[model samples]
Target: MINYLHREQILPAPIEKVWAYFCDPKNLNEITPPDMKFEIVSGGDVKMYEGQVVEYRVEFVRGLRSLWLTEIAHVRENEYFVDEQRVGPYRFWYHEHSFESVPAGVKMTDHVTYAAPFGLIGDVVNAVWIRQRLNGIFDFRYQKIVELFGSVK
Candidate 1:
């Protein structure tokens, strides 16, 4: 079954600043949890653009390292970008990052749609593990972003 996660955060920063930070593929490692050992294997040097491909290595399941390949499917400067998985542990993964200027600052939203592998077993795993793991990852990201960009208050 397909699963979805949506999150929004108001960052105390200008849209251009937040957009610049997110546009650099390398910044992903900065926001990701260090325990995951997330590393960009290649294709992370330049700013994100439609058709850009990025490869990464991360320890996700049972601490086993896995390779993830993704392509930037769509990009609208200072607005939004979508990335789709090409090769990864998941059966399918699509993530959209969007930004809007709010009275407080920049409102950033993350929308993720993904499906697990192994059918019924995958569903069970997601129910017990993957779901929480993904939440934790995003939680970490939120904290890191706040630390880097300051709080909305």
Candidate 2:
């Protein structure tokens, strides 16, 4: 089964500046929670581009590290970009980050479609734990972005 997650935030910054920040893979660590221990193991120095493959080392649960490999599947300048999992814990993962210029500033949106490993058991785990964990991760990202860029006002 595929699960979806969506979140939107408006920042008090121009679309160009916001796009630059999000397009750089290195900046991901800054927005992610410290406890997750998210780090780019390779291919993060250069800015994102189509077919770019990035590797990461992450500890989603404390002390349990996992290697995640993803490819930048699509890009459209300051409009949107998508990253799909090539190798990771998830059975499938595709994330789209979109940006638009709003009257207040830039409206950023995150849309994720993913499925956990296993079958019925995975769905049960997702319902009991994974879903909440994903929500918390995005919540941290939203707060961190607001702290870094300031809220739309």
Candidate 3:
């Protein structure tokens, strides 16, 4: 069962600043929820560029470690980038990070399409837990972004 999630946030910063911060692999740790214990296992210093691959370990399932690997499949500098999961729990994971210049500030959007491991069970999991967990994760991310760059307008 494929599912989608979208989140938009206005950062009180210029597009260039926001783009640079988000495109840096190091800042990923800063925006991610601390409770997840997210850590970059590889490509920590590598810049977010097309073809760049990053590996991370996150304790999302009850403090158990899970490995996730992603590749920068597409990039339009200062505009948007797409990261596709190469190896992970998800059957499919594609995330697009887009930024636009607005009068108030930069409008950043996160668009994700993913499917869990099991089929029918995955659908149930998404409904019962995965979906809610995703919402919580993104909610945390949104708040952290606001804390870092201040709220929009």
lDDT of 1 by residue, 96-152 (tens): 999999999999999999999999999999999999999999999999998999887
Q: Which stretches of candidate 3 lie over 4 Å from their true place?
A: none
- All candidates: TM-score: 0.98, 0.98, 0.97
The residue pairs in collision within model 2 are: none
Worst 10 residues of 3 by lDDT: 144-153
lDDT of 3 by residue, 2-108 (tens): 89999999887998898888889999888787888999999869678899999999877876889999999999988999999999879999999999998899999
Model 1 stretches astray by more than 4 angstroms: none
Number of backbone-clashing residue pairs for each candidate, in the order shown: 0, 0, 0
Model 2 over residues 1-153: C-alpha lDDT tens digits?
999999999999999999999999999999999999998999999999999999999998888999999999999999999999999889999999999999999999999999999999999999999999999999999999999899966
On the 0 to 100 scale, the lDDT of residue 24 in model 2 is 97
* Cα lDDT, model 2, residue 152: 66
- Candidate 3, overall lDDT? 0.90
In candidate 1, how many Å is residue 94 off?
0.5
> What is the alpha-carbon RMSD of candidate 1 to the true structure?
0.8
